[model samples]
Target: MITSKLMRPLTTGGVLASTVLFASGCKSMIVFDPKGPIGEQQRDLIYFTMLLCLIILVPVLLIAAWIVWRYRDRKNNRAPYQPVWSHSTKLEIVWWGIPIVIIVVLAVVTARYTYALDPAKPIESDKKPVTIQVTSLDWKWLFQYPEQGIATVNYLAIPERTPIKFELTSDGPMNGFWVPQLGGMIYTMSGMATTMYLQADEPGNYMGTGANFTGRDFAKMGFTAKALPQKDFDRWVADAKASGNALTEEGYQTLAKPGTTDRMTFASIPSGLFERIVHDYSMSRGAPPGYTLRAVTLSEEKKAEHTAHPKNGQLPPGNGAQKDAPDAQSLGQPDHRSGHMHLIHGK
Candidate 1:
């Protein structure tokens, strides 16, 4: 009857859009509510890749609702019409062998959780990780704490069940660093140096952010992690090392320039100020003063005088945007294994 009155307003508009997405609650989905052990091993590898994509989406939605209710548009609808019904080799080997065995069991469960969530490895813990550092300025987020020498800025605290190493870099440009309950999102570039590790197993506060977008005070960067409880993170690192506020190196180059402030605290940081902000972006006179660094390349005779000889060299057209320097410099290298995404030059 006109397809049950057009599926009764498309099944009541998909049950009022799933009751307005279940009344929008999920406690701000802190990445499926994780709280540590690397966000519960990345939420159990996102619930085993959504239970292997609902085993190919519940058998292709119950065989597309039993081939639309056994071939509808009926009046004496005796189903099996077949009308030169194309080939089948057992339904094309059961739909291409069940998506190649669900893509080889999702590439062996994403290469065994990308080496078990390797945001720079180290998170075994009977407690002894802590480090910190970070940086990502121009919008903000400093952190430091080199074994509690202390430093803060947008703020982070750490400790609950221990194991946080971090390190990251960037006085600007590259960004990322997230903390959706305590795991993924790493990045933060500028003259390299990255590494993550994380942990948390309870205690609270969370929030952190800056998953990229660098411009207009990229929504004021954000930061606040907290965690606490190793004697409340050693009494909040002894009240941030007795906040006699120091920071130096001219106050971390005026808190790495470009704006946004509040939530500061120091009490000494500036010995190797995050190893000179990762060696001031491989300085040969580059990324330091007001460090912005989005592209970084130069040299190799200015990359063979900005290459692109197209018309005769051909292939130099569309997909541009790659001036280079996006990954590998592992500052003072000790194999900062964010699985090295290539580009390692900087002498």
Candidate 2:
């Protein structure tokens, strides 16, 4: 049937459309942009590692294929059956020494670059590195500039090609901080700090997001990282500081609640905002665990009377006749006149 013949092409067309749509939806697939020295070093490291791996892999793979085709049983008509011969010093040395050399080379190269790119290190620049404190909350990101006294949610803007250092922490669960074109992803946890460096070489807007899995709105937990000229960035900051209401301690307490979606910016940032977020005082209160000891002592204090005698009334406070020696008479027969009883009473 013509319908049946058309179905195959139609199905293929649908599959192709879906694949293109999926890839298009994820547009920020670009890895590293060599804006700053740090990003350049990271890109270099990746390229070098890949190139070195291919060097050893390509030769080994080609040699394997050549041996299989040249020594096939069909070409020889009769393959020799011989006793095992294991000892080959040259081949064994080549295989073992090659891998060892590769590992040593990789280790030395990676270690040197890793220390150089340490976030705490001071990179040489004509101007000072801008400081930004980032806090990850449940389903939202808070960016605060202690120096500028401004705050923004889900958006960060800095001068292009200027070194920017981020001191990152979290108020809620853990999250990953990533700006794909700028650099790699790092983690943020409550009460702990992590740092990352990035600079936009090209003056443009880049997308950044949390690479870690969070709750419902995790997919939308992203923002725009804008790189602008110094003058333009300053103007933007000034305009933001003048437009909206000042964010105070009370304002932050209200915003600290979970489930903030998309982006919001605060015109005025509260003083000591970062410190308060780190040492959260608004946690729910409860009786300390050491209260159990107090409970036991109070229970003992509340008891009014304690009985000592089982056959009759409570015994007196002291022993009227103390026995200096063990009594042999009570071993065989019941002693009804035992006067060595004591009573404890709490009132």
Candidate 2: the clashing residue pairs are none
RMSD of each: 20.4, 13.5
Tens digits of per-residue lDDT, candidate 2, 1-347, equal 89999999999999999999986865544664455566778889988998889879999999999999876778447757775878999999998999899989999999999898777676677878898999887788889988887888889998987888898888777899988777767898776777777777778887789988878878878888999999999998898888776778887777767886567777878787786666552332222234221121222222212222235533343332122222323222333565322222222
Q: State every prediction's TM-score relative to the real structure.
A: 0.33, 0.71
What tens-digit string does per-residue lDDT give for candidate 1 at 209-285?
99989999888888789887888778777886787878788877877889888898887777887887778677744
Evaluated with lDDT, which candidate comes out highest?
Answer: 1
* Highest-TM-score candidate: 2
Query: All candidates' lDDT scores?
Result: 0.77, 0.74
Which regions of candidate 1 fall more than 4 Å away from where they truly are?
1-7, 14-16, 19-27, 32-37, 40-48, 51-55, 73-87, 90-96, 103-107, 118-128, 131-180, 183-204, 207-235, 239-347
Worst 10 contiguous positions by lDDT, candidate 1: 324-333
